[model samples]
Target: MGKVLTQDAQRFMVDCLKAVGAGKKPALQQAELLIEADKMGHHSHGMNRLELYVNDIKTGKCQPNNECKILKESEATAWVDACNVLGATSSHFCMDLAIKKAGKAGVGWVSSKGGNHNGIMGFWARKAAKEGMIGMAFTNTSPLCPPTRGKQPVLGTNPLSVVAPGAQDELFYLDMATTAVAFGKIEIQRRKGKPLHPGWAQGTDGKITVDPEEASKARILLPLGGGEMTSGYKGFGLAAVVELFCGVLAGSKYGHHVRTWSLAEGGEPANLGQCFVAVNTSCFAPGFQDRVAAIMQHWRSIEPTEPCLRVKCPGDRERRNKEEAESKGTVTYLDSQIKSSAALAKKLNVTPMQVTAE
Candidate 1:
């Protein structure tokens, strides 16, 4: 593995984006989105995705400089066109608009279409939380999940995130995909030459399998519960609900129509759909933050079922990861990631990143 300073990693990402014709601000915003994921230990959405973004921009599948426009609006709702902009650009635009609207209307809801792959839905959700409001975000991705008992994949992992400020500097955060696991988990296991956990995915036969190789090739992700015996269909229902907030509401590519966005770059624009919502807590009774903090505190104080582990709230793990990463001032990448990143820099004619061994 190679360790790179976080700031330098961010710089390298921005440079790569710029090499593909993204403007300064857009490149930085997009890079920040990726870096934050790495910082928060969500490698699936972080630097692991830089190559895809670079290739998309290089191939004109994503327009980093395009301006998102509000197609229609009311006091509390908006319909937007991302104009094929980079995900971070459109996400920031919509989330900020939602926050502004919530300030006036008690709640703001925005739906957008024509978006590219937006990294980490939680990033946008946290934006509203920073403003002392409840933040919610959802987005549809390329289809990688099959409906229950079906042979072919149809729906996406389709993630949702909700975050809010809490009392005593605590926070409530939840970001999750409807699938049992992201396809990236399969890739990570495959890279390590390891088998997958049961229920993580389905094999070609559309049944649960533990072979990483087969699961990756099968590409049919199971819902959260895995199979009918485990009530996986309920997880499937939740995924459908997220789709309703995104592609169905935004009128973009829905369900099976969304294309598979693999590691390659030469396809049409993703044109994914997304939703961002913000609700003002001040609109409710007083002591909202205090109540939230108290609840989180109660959860944390509970006795652990296992002596080696302690109970934690939704945001606890991510917060700990962020704090640790900051204290170290560096992010570690797999040796494979370092090699690919160097290769990408050479391909894009950008300065390569410096790394520390150990």
Candidate 2:
């Protein structure tokens, strides 16, 4: 493992994005998105994804300088064309719009087409939460997860996030991929020379496999519950719901129509779909934040099934991770990540990230 100062990591990401043709604001915004993932302990979406963004820009698949436009709007809803901008730019614009509309209308819904990969969905959802409203974010990606009992992938991980702010700085935050695991986890395991855990993926033969290489090659992720008997179909259903909100509603690439997930190749623009929603709690109830905080506290007070492992509320782990990273002022990366980032910097002719002593 290698440790890097948080600012250095952000700078490296910004530099890499700029080197690949992204403008200053777009690059910095995108880098902020990636760095937040690292701070929250989601290594898969952090620096791990920098090369993919660079490739997208290099191949002209993403136009970081382009402007997003509203195609249609009502009192509480909007349809946006992201115009193939960087995911951070598009997501910030949409979520900000949602929050603004919710301030007056009590609820806001915005669906967008032509987005690129947008780091972690939770980051976007938390934006409205900070404004004392309930927030939701969803996005469609390249197809990588198979429906329950199916051999072929028909949906992306199709992540969703919901966040609500509470009193005393408490929160109810839930963000998850519909699949058993995000594809980035598989890539991380492969990078670490590790095997997959059972129930995570299937081989090309459609049977469960613990081999990371096989899982990566097959590109078939299981639904969250793993198999038919385990109710994996529930997760499959959730992925479909996200797709409905994103691709189907937004009229972008949907389901199998989405492109393949790849790092080495850039084809047509992803034209991916995304959705954001905000609901002003003040419109429906008073003391909303107090109630939310109480419930989270109650959950934490529950008896643990294992004494050593206490029960926690939805956002506790991520909050703890962020606090720890902040206290240290550093993020840790795998040796492979460090080496690859160095190679990327050399390729882009940008200054490499400086590592701190562990």
Candidate 3:
């Protein structure tokens, strides 16, 4: 297995998936989405997730050939069924539809049910920002976080993301989970046999935990705040709001009722729900770009706590990361990760690459 740069690695990944049965366009899109995550410095949601997606396909939890359908539509909203297709494909389809509707109606909302993990939410939000619209997306998942005072994992790491387009170069974006950390973060630590920081999660009995492996099995992540006293209650509140939209509004499973991503034991998709909304700014104001530019300029002018660093907007770091990866021609991968990816490739009858392959 190799830790090839983002571009080459994604090309290989798309080719491998296409060879295995995914349609050309769908495979390519999925590969691009994952690689983009790596480039943006979020490895937990990047290629590491490809193994899960591929496994889901092999186990029949995610069908590469399934087609998503719009079950209902209205002037400002729609409901979609993924038909158990790959999450990336269904999410892209829905976001594109939402953008189209928003262009016509000034705003559009789309709710999707019966889909699996869709990777990072930023990818979809950025799609709308690129189209000159404000984009927002939210999703619910299997229980991974605990409520304010609970020790049991009673809530999904339900996440929300938003993107607002800027003038010419920058975009404002935010993507975060309702919990302090996602399951993937814990999983990564567990794989490395490392200890997690206190307050990130709680043991089964509601005690703070530091052992990642133990934490994964018996602990639940604390809500946005570690102990209720901190402002994490605000985060908890927002998380609940997302749950209402993704679960209650969509009539999907809520809180502890959701299912995990495992498939080997006959586990299927959690029938997760997601919400996507797009707002066309041109309908609301003329010269929106100029307005955005002025606001960001004012923000940057704020006195820096450290003179070496300048105040930056939300999307700036990601753009910088992408540029570095492109120029360097390679992205880093953990040694264990490369090995695991090799095993997966072999199991799927695909040839794995070396890091320095010409």
For each candidate, give its TM-score against the true structure: 0.97, 0.95, 0.91
Top model number, TM-score: 1
Better of 2 and 3 by lDDT: 2
lDDT scores for all predictions?
0.92, 0.93, 0.80
Model 2 lDDT tens row, 1-358: 8999999999999999999889999999999999999999999999998998899888888999999999999989999999999999999999999999999999999999999999999999999999999999999987877877778889989999999999998989999998999777888899899988888998988888899999889989998888888898998999999999999999999999998646756589999999999999999878999999999999889999999999988888999999999999999998889999999999999999998556
Candidate 2 ranges beyond 4 A from true positions: 184-198, 210-213
The worst-scoring run of ten residues by lDDT in candidate 3 lies at 261-270
Model 1 worst lDDT window (10 residues): 259-268
| lDDT at residue 48 of model 2 (Cα atoms) | 94
- Candidate ranking (TM-score, best to worst): 1, 2, 3
Model 3 TM-score relative to the real fold: 0.91
lDDT string for model 3 (60-83, tens) is 677778898899999889899877
